[model samples]
Target chain A: MTDAYSSSRLVAGVRTGQQRSIARMISRIELGAPGVDLELAELYGSAGRAHVVGVTGAPGSGKSSLVSALAASLRRDGKLVGILAVDPSSPFSGGALLGDRIRMSDHSGDGGVYIRSMATRGALGGLARATTDAITVLDAAGMELVLVETVGVGQAEVDIVRTAHTTLVVSIPGTGDEIQTIKAGVLEIADIHVVNKADRDGANRIIRDLTGMLRLGPPTPPGEWRAPVLGTVATEGRGIDALAAALHEHYAFLAAGDGLEQRERAMASARVSAIAQNLVAERLTDSGLGDRAAQILDEVYHRTLDPFSAATALVRVTT
Target chain B: MTDAYSSSRLVAGVRTGQQRSIARMISRIELGAPGVDLELAELYGSAGRAHVVGVTGAPGSGKSSLVSALAASLRRDGKLVGILAVDPSSPFSGGALLGDRIRMSDHSGDGGVYIRSMATRGALGGLARATTDAITVLDAAGMELVLVETVGVGQAEVDIVRTAHTTLVVSIPGTGDEIQTIKAGVLEIADIHVVNKADRDGANRIIRDLTGMLRLGPPTPPGEWRAPVLGTVATEGRGIDALAAALHEHYAFLAAGDGLEQRERAMASARVSAIAQNLVAERLTDSGLGDRAAQILDEVYHRTLDPFSAATALVRVTT
Candidate 1:
């Protein structure tokens, strides 16, 4: 496969909803292959049609099962669904395990449902960019609904979840003070909160606690949508319909006012800024200023030059 | 207390190990005050003398108790200790809770121990910069040992932990499958791993799991230090002495060859790059190019401009 030939064919196949092409494009983006930029430019027009939904929670929150159930529900509504599971886990365990595959097996042979798992490779910021690009690819491939799942570990993961049009934060019962950690950063980003494993003990208390926390915050504006907490036993397919309905409700809310447009604008600004920063860093390295930067870093490390001054100098030289 | 006078006085007092001055300086850094660059430049020389240690773990892992225990043990050896706890939790809580303060009350009014907690107040990346600056301030204040503690949530938190000379990753027993989450990213960064709450069941299993995982990788070089997995019951101060000894041994290992220098150089490079990126972002915003950037973002959002091209253009203009 020649580079030019494959690139053009991949773009065409992706536009027509070919699974192999979509996977290939995502792989290229993940690997940071040459000329992927041009391919992305060609496909950019086809994106912005799919609704990107981000699902996030701690490990063992049963988010995988919840996501699979949600996807099945969306498929029942005749929507073409694409799922991107962002695994920040180590490379030793490549992709999803057998259990995850079995959980998502219902959609395996369905042409309308596509699933891909992405591992955290390279820098953390790069992972975010890759995930965003993957979402774009899915969106461009004519999927009406796209699901992005990630574990909430730190700020970076939370930021990734924030990029979605609607974010579902999943949690389980009996987590104890673990909810406190979620309240700190993750809760604020959620458009819909899910208490998965609702059959487990303390589920109602978890919901009540979340509601109380929500109440303690400043009141929502009259027209703005408030995040609704839902319960689900994902394995039993309980509450999946209500969860899907809530997702649609939030999406409608975003589309009603300038909310959706505003979010898109903010996301675009962030994306551009991230890309520009990476480019600046790469430019500095590629332009032979890396050695100079290293020298200044040494000076800063040895206390001969202050970091602020060293940074200023490096920026001047690189720019 | 004019600006110039206070800045100079703050530097002088910090150099002399004054607690009030250190607090004020950290406050200025966290708030992104105008004159902090000058203050930092003056204090840079006094740094590079303290051995910086970072403690990180998931919330509810007893990291606070572990840190406190380690600090007390270090103090027993006649070393002054400074502690900076980076709380990614929200601002409504306002620093450490009374419970946390009570936990460390044994060191209260002790001049040799200084503890300050930092909350995430402003931008995400800003927290990392402020944390690094706070470390510098503490180092300049004649502290022989400094502990930088943070909750492991996402990549940003992990990056902050990596800045330390020795990073201790704390975990509790029976965290089943949660350790799998840890293996993805955090395990690779640990200089020493502590399974706190050693009296609990499954502590040995967790240790065996970690050791087995470590053995699956290639053999460590002869001179390089292998990350040690230790068990601790931090609340009871069990294994505190051994933990402290391991820390000292790691410090010696770092100081033996060019290991310490190499780490310092890498940290310095990262610091400079971060500051430079921030400066570029600030400069772009301050010079009226922010509006232009936003306009480009708007175009990208509307799909009139591709993000890649927009980013390239923005980089060209800013650089």
Candidate 2:
């Protein structure tokens, strides 16, 4: 079949919420296969309907289990849910996804929930871009809600969380060194805080500390939302209902004001910049600019021209 | 003075190893002041002499203390040193640099050692590129050894360490779960492993664990170097000499083969790509393309155009 015909059929399948087509489309997007951008463009108009929520924490914070519990709860609510587990540090192991899949097998045969894992096989920027695309795929596939779970609290993970409408920062008791956690800047981004493993010792203290820290933060403007700290034993499914209710409430809060539109615009701008960067870099290696790029790179390697200057010259050449 | 004349004077000062001039140049580089590219282009020919080493670890791993000890040892051996302490998570509480400075005051009056702390106030990619520029400034200023210290084990930190000729991964006892540490991908990048605070209990076991992990890694070619795990009581000045020796030996191993040249070429390509991306983004904002770019972004915002498709159109227009 022609590429156009195949891509159109895939797009139609995604619109009808076909699972096989969704998975195949995501694979193509991640690989940057030819003509995928056209497919994405056709599907893009159908997005902006799914609520994207990001869950992030350090390892051992029970992020996976919490995400699983949340997904189960959402499923019970009659909402079609999609989960994307992003592991940026799993360059070697590649096993995090498998373990998560096994844990999420309870929803295997159900069409109401879809689970997928994304690992970093190349640049962090590329992984993030691919993630944005994959979310679009799931969103186009009629998923009412998409959950993004990142394994570490580094800058890359933080960037991923910024894509979500509501972000949850998960913490557990007795991780050692309170100072490091504070310094990580997690407090600034969370729309909600989940103290997982509440059955463990020190859970109450952590909850109180987070509440105090939120109080100490800058005062919220009138009509703005304030993040709430809650405790949960995710394994036992305790507090899952409250967490699910909070998500709905937060979505309503955003929809009540201009916050939703503002966030969508911001996310759109970020996406444009990332894609523009990739295009510019690829253009340099294209047929017309390839020889000049090589020459410029050689000069940079030999120190005859600095990198910034070479970049300036290359941009000028393109224009 | 005219910009050209003043920039020339600054370059001359840097070549003569004037600390004040070096500081000013690095500030200009970091802030990306106007005309800094020309200055760097002129100074680039004088670099490629400094031996760049990277030290990275998790927070509370005593990386700063170990770095200070290593710097003092390098000074004792009559080497001019420059240290860049990179903190990618310090979005708020810029206090990390202040605390680090207080601890590093021992070298305050020493003309042979220079220390600086870099925090993330913008994109992680921008910080990494600025770091590469700062390293070049120090190299042009006649520093014989430059050390880069990072406080996290994320992908961003890993990318920063890849710029170094030799990378040392620091570890400490009682940092909690061994599985999390191992999953961080720190083991694959180490040229040497240091178990800081060796006087503490379980230091030996940590060292043994690192050594065993290294042994289980891929076998080295006959002439290739194998990383060694050592214990260090950094606060007491114990084992600093051995760590310094390992660094020198690793550099020599690289210099003995094509490793040094290969690494330099790879670094050059990365710098070029980063600079090129920045230039392309900037060009899209220039007079000719700015209005068109805004229109395209608006279309993307309204879901009339996908970001990838918009980017492709922008690149085509630029060419």
Best by DockQ: 2
Q: Give the alpha-carbon lDDT of every model.
A: 0.79, 0.81
- Each predicted complex: what DockQ? 0.39, 0.41
* TM-score of each model's chain B: 0.91, 0.92
Which lDDT tens digits does candidate 2 get at residues B197-227?
Answer: 8898888788888888877877887888888
Per-residue CA lDDT of model 1 for B1-319, tens digit only, reads 3389877998999999999999899988878888998899889878988899988877678888899999889999999999988865443233564346765587987899999887766554677788888999999999998999886545666778888899988878886534653655577788898888989999898888787877888989899899999999988999999999999999999999899988888777677767766765564442435566667767888888988888777654112
Kindly report the root-mean-square deviation of model 1 from the true structure over all alpha carbons.
3.4
Candidate 1, pairs of clashing residues = A90-B184, A153-B153, A153-B154, A154-B153, A154-B154
The DockQ for candidate 2, computed on C-alphas, is: 0.41
Candidate 2's error at B134, in angstroms? 1.6
Q: After superposing candidate 1, which stretches have Cα over 4 Å from the reference?
A: A88-99, A171-174, A198-216, A281-291, A316-319, B58-60, B89-94, B97-99, B171-178, B198-215, B280-291, B316-319
Instruction: Residues A192-303, candidate 1: write the lDDT tens digits.
Output: 9899999999999988988888889999989998999999999899999999999988889999998998888777766766766666556444243556665776788889
